[model samples]
Each structure stands twice: as C-alpha cells, then as structure tokens.
Target: MSRGSTLAEKIIGRAAGHAVQPGDLAVVAVGMAMSVDSIAPSVIKVMREEFRIPKVADPEKVALFVDHVAPACNVSTAEGQAEVRRFAAEQGIRHLYDVGTGVCHQLMIDRGLARAGEVVLGSDSHSTAYGAIGAFGTGMGATDIALAFATGKTWLRVPETMKVELTGQLPAGVMSKDAILHLIGRLGIDGATYRAVEFYGAEDLTAASRITLCSMTTELGAKAGMIAFPQERLAEFGLPEWLFADPDAGYVHAETIDLAALSPQVSSPDDVDNVSSVDAVVGIHIDQVFLGTCTNGRLEDIHAAARILKGRRVAPHVRMIIIPASDDILKQSVADGSLISLLEAGATVSTPGCGPCIGRHQGVLAAGEACFSTANRNFRGRMGSPEADIYLGSPLTAAATALEGKIADPRNYL
Candidate 1:
C-alpha cells in the first residue's frame, strides 16, 4: 500500500519524478526561480564565475526584480540594478520586473508564473507567498539559486510537516493578518523551524487573504507555507488531484484555531513574536502608519483600509503611507477611486513596490519614532532606525491607528 504523504511531499515527489517522504533529500526540477535586485548580482556572479554558464538553464523559468531600493536610491543601488538588467538582456530573460513594477512575489502570481503543484524557488524569504496559490515555494541563498539557474534543478531535504487548521469564520473587523500574527505569537519566533506548514479549513479565504496567511508564515520560521487552495478557483491551472495532504498523513505539530473567536492582533516592536491584544497596547503614540507590503498590500487589504478612512482624515501627527502590491492593483485602486479616497484622507501613496518595508527607502522611520505597519516582520531596525519601533497589524488596525495616531484597535472603528 502507498503511504500517505503531505502536500509538500507529494509536490516534491512530482518534481523529483518519484515518491518522497519526510527527511528524504532529493534533487528536483524547478518550475521557476526568482531573484530580487538586491541579490540578483550575487546570483549572476556565481553563475558566471563559478559555473561559467553562458545563460540560465531556462530563461522562461527565471525571473528578476528591482523592488528593494527601487528607483535607484543612490549610485550604488542604481549600478546594481543596471547589472541585473544587463544580465537579463544578455540571457534573454523576459521576466525581469523593473523598478515600480511591484514586489517580486506579487508580480510572479499576477503573471501566472506560479501555479498549483509547482516548485517555485525565490531569493527572497517571502517566496512562501507562492504557497497561497498552492505552489511549493521556498527561499534559497545566492549559491543555491545560481546553481538552480544554471541547471534548473536543486537538492533539498524534505522537511517535516506541521498542520495549522482553522475552523469557523473570521469575526467582524478581524483580518487574516490578525490571525497570522496571533498564530505566530503562540508558536514563538522559531516555532516551526525548517518545517512545512500545511493549512487546512479556511476554505473561504480569498486569494489575497491566503497570500497574507502564507507570506506571514515565514515569521514562524517556516520553510514553506501551503494552503489546500480551492480547486475550483484554480481550475485553469489544472492543479493535480493530490494537491492537498493525504487524509492519513502525519504532522510534527498540529494546531487548531477557531477563527470566529479571534480578534484584532498585533506584534510589538523589535520582534514579530512580541504579540498582544490591541487593547493592551493602546494609547502609545504612533508617528507613522504604513499600509503596504507583499504580505498585506493586495486589493482586499487596500479596500479594507479605504472603508475605514473614507470619511475621515489621518490624525495631525501621524504620517500615513500606502503602496499597492503591483501596478495592476494600483490601477485597480485608481479605477475604483480607493486611491483618491486614501489620498483625501491625508494618506500619502508611493510607487508600487516594497516601499520602506526593508529599511532602505520610501518612508523609513526616524530615531525615537514608532510606526504602525501592515508589513510582516517587525524586528529591530527592520524599517529604519534601530532606535525606532514598529507595530505590525492589519489594514483595519493600520487605518484606525492613522486616524487616532496611536495603536488603536480596528473593532472600535468598525
């Protein structure tokens, strides 16, 4: 009899052309490999110098991005992006998403580069974002990515699986961002170290919501995050019959969370795991409110914040910034007037990319300041100054914080 295998195992098995189990090391063919501008130079150098490869194994399967420090913050960054562009041109890599196109992960999904039951590797940690669409997405270092680019195959140790099951519907005013933060808090920073987290239930999660859930799973130290994506929704992708975990598969750790019982959750400064209820952290002044990132910068999140900021303007001392996930989402927001509404509410909008989330450019915080950001990851010095602090929350909470200039809860405004 065939042994039951988890989603990660099955997808990997397909890629490796054989059945696999946890702890098995296998070299699998990659469906796609993405590299961001910040690290593309390293990958390019490694491929040329180490492997002496004339070009990547498959140009169609490779992607590059100029998201971090986009728009050329300085001479150094501008030169670095130029190098990436040169390589893409020389290698005929047609998928190089240049500055302001959006975050690499968002563009990958929007462009249909990642699909269900495929193996997508990225140079960015948030490559787990691909899991929202049921892809086996994981991040790798420069050398590994270069090797994959040169050979279209890479070896990986199959990780044990962890099950995160959600039952019941999300309560009023509660966002998927809140649920992830709460889960991360419970599991601690390193809770699921090197583990593949497979989500069950939450069948109604929108594509955007699923992306948020999987993207933030990286905060739990997860190697990959997979949701049993609704098959009907991804019909065009022709997802395999066994995209989900087998019924009899085992889990290293299983956690059950009732979505209906959840409320707005937040992660405090210096650490994503430093979490507490919004009620516990209210009244603390927030100098800035940033509502965008690969985690929560999708259309749904923008709509939620627009609804909150519709008839109100941001508080006097609070600086609100909103950057959509991609140009497509940005255009959609404009067509729907959400962008104007947010701008009218005294919120500043920036180029469609990873704006200020990586402490590089586009809204970096000042010393002694605090920011309420919808982006994942809030470790010390993540956004800007090490002395500054960041509070991670949902779009609703972020809008409320912008209105009240403090760590305010979304429930009150809702």
Candidate 2:
C-alpha cells in the first residue's frame, strides 16, 4: 500500500513526475517566475553575462514588474526600469506590469497568473503570496531566478509540512490580519523555519483573507505556505483531490488558531514577530497611517477601512495614505465609492503599486516619527530612518489609528 503524502509532497511529486517526500530535492518546471525592477537588472545580467544563455525556455512564462521604487524614484531607478523594458520587449515577454500596476504577487493573482497545484517563483520573499491560490510559490535568489529564466526550471528541497489548523469563525471587528499576527506571535520568528505550512481548516476564511494568511508565512520563516481546499473551494480554485493533504499525511508540527477568540493584533516595530493585541499598544501616537501592500491591499481590505472612515475625518495631526494593490482594485474602489470615502476622510491616494510598503518613496517615515501600516515586515529601518517606528495591523486597525491619531483598537470604531 502507498503511504499518505502531504499537500506539498503531492504538488511537488506531480511537478516532478514522480513521488516525493520531505527532504527530497526536486527540479520542476516553473509555471511562472517573476522579477521586480530592483533585482531584474542583476537577474538579467546573470543570465546574459554569466551563463550567456540564448533564448529563455519560455518567455511567456516569465514576468517582470517595475513596482518597487516605481515612477522613477531616482535617475538610477529610471535607468534600471528602462533596461527591464528593453529586455522584455526584446525577449517577447508580455507579462511586464510597469509603474502604477501594483505589486508582483497581487498582479499575479489579479491576472490569474497563479494557479492551484502549480509552482510559481518570484525574486521577492513575499513571493510566497502565490500560495494563496494553492500554488507552490517560493522565493529564490537572483542567481537561481536567472537560471530559472534561462531554463524554465528550478530545484527545491521538499520541506517538511507543518499543519496549522484554523477553526471557528472570526468575531466581528477582527480581520484575517489579526489571525496571522496571532499565529506569527505564537510561532515566533523562526518557528516554521524551512517548512511548508498548510492551513487545514481554512474554509471560514474569505478568499482575500486566505491570501493575507498565506503571504505572511514568510514571516514564520516558512519555505512554502498552502491551504487545503474544501470540496466547494476545490472547484473554485481548480484544485485536484490530491492537492488536499491526505488524512494520514505526516506533519513535522501542528497548531490550531481559533479565530473567534482572536482580537485585533499588531506587530510592533523592528520585528515582524513582535506582536501583541491591539489593546496592549493602544494610544501610541502615530504620524501616518498607510493602507496597502500585497498583504492587505485588496478590495475587501479597502472596504474595511472605508467602513471605519466613512463620515469620519482623519485626525488633524495624522496623515492617511491608501494605495490599492492593483489597477483593477483601484477601479473597483473608485466605482464602489470606497475610494471617495477614504479621500473625503482626509486620506491621500497614490498610484496603485507598492507605494511605501518598501519605504523607498510615497510614505517614508522621518526620524522620531511613527506609522501604522498594513504592509508586512516592520524590520528596523524597513520604511525609512531606523529611528522611525512602524506598527503593523489590519486596515480596520489602521483606519482606527488615523481616526484617533494613535494606535487605537479597530473594535472600538467598529
């Protein structure tokens, strides 16, 4: 009799055209490999200068995004973007999303570039976001990405599985961001190091929420994050039966999160894992409140903020910025009037892209300043001056902060 295999095992096995288990090395065809502007120059260089490869295995499978430091933050960035444009045109790559198009991972899902049970690669660590749709997505270095671009293939050591079971409905005023923050806090920074985390009981989570949950797996130091699709969702995601983890599949570790009991959580500055409940850090003065990023930049997140900010003006001392994750989301928000609500509430809007998530432009923090941001990662100096502080939370939490000019609980406003 055959042994039961995990979600990661089965996906990797199918891609490898053979059975695979934890610790196995498998070189599989990449469905898509994404490179952002900041690293595309080096990726292209390695492919051309080092390997001297001619003609990528499939130009159609390669994607490039000029999102980070977009709109020419500086002359050097402008030149780098130009190089990417020339290369894409020359190589017949049609998946280039230039400035204002939003994040690479968001664009990937927005355009249906990521599919269930497939492998997706990105140059950014948050590439794990692709796992939102049940795809085997992971980040690779410039050299590995260049090699994948040249041959349309890359290898990964199959990671052991960590089953994270999420049960119970999330109570009112709580968001998926809180659940993920709670998980990260309990698991610690390196809790799931080099492991694949599969959410076993995620049926209650909205599709957008699932994206938020999966993308933050990187903070747990996970290699890949996957969600086991329920029968109804299986059809929606086009996932196969095998894509679901077997009942008897082995797991390196397991934990459960009860959403109903979870409250709004926050990741304090200088560490993504430095998390606590909203009440614990309430009333901390905030200079800026930013709402956008692959983590919380979708329409649902925007609606959450609008619900809180509608008819309420931002505090006079606070600056609020909302950037949609994609052009489509931007249009939807505008059509639905949520964008107007945010703007009327004294929030400024930037072009739909990464914005200040990376801290290069848009909403950089000043020394001694503090911001409440929806983006992932709040490492020291992550957004600007190391002296500046960043507080990570849900859009609802961010809206509450903007409304009060401090780190207030979203539950209070909701």
* Top candidate (TM-score): 2
Locate the minimum summed-lDDT window of 10 residues in model 2: 230-239
Question: Over the full model, what C-alpha lDDT does candidate 1 score relative to the true structure?
Answer: 0.90
Model 2 pairs in collision: none
Error of 1 at 47 (Å): 1.1
lDDT (10s digit) by residue, model 2, range 137-254: 8988899999999999889999999999898998888998998899999999898999999997876678889899889999999988888786555766667655677888899899
lDDT of 1 by residue, 27-66 (tens): 8999999999899999999998998987899999999999
- The superposed Cα distance between candidate 2 and the true structure at residue 33, in angstroms, equals 0.6
* TM-score of every candidate: 0.97, 0.98
TM-score for predicted model 1 compared with the true structure = 0.97
lDDT assessment of candidate 2: 0.90
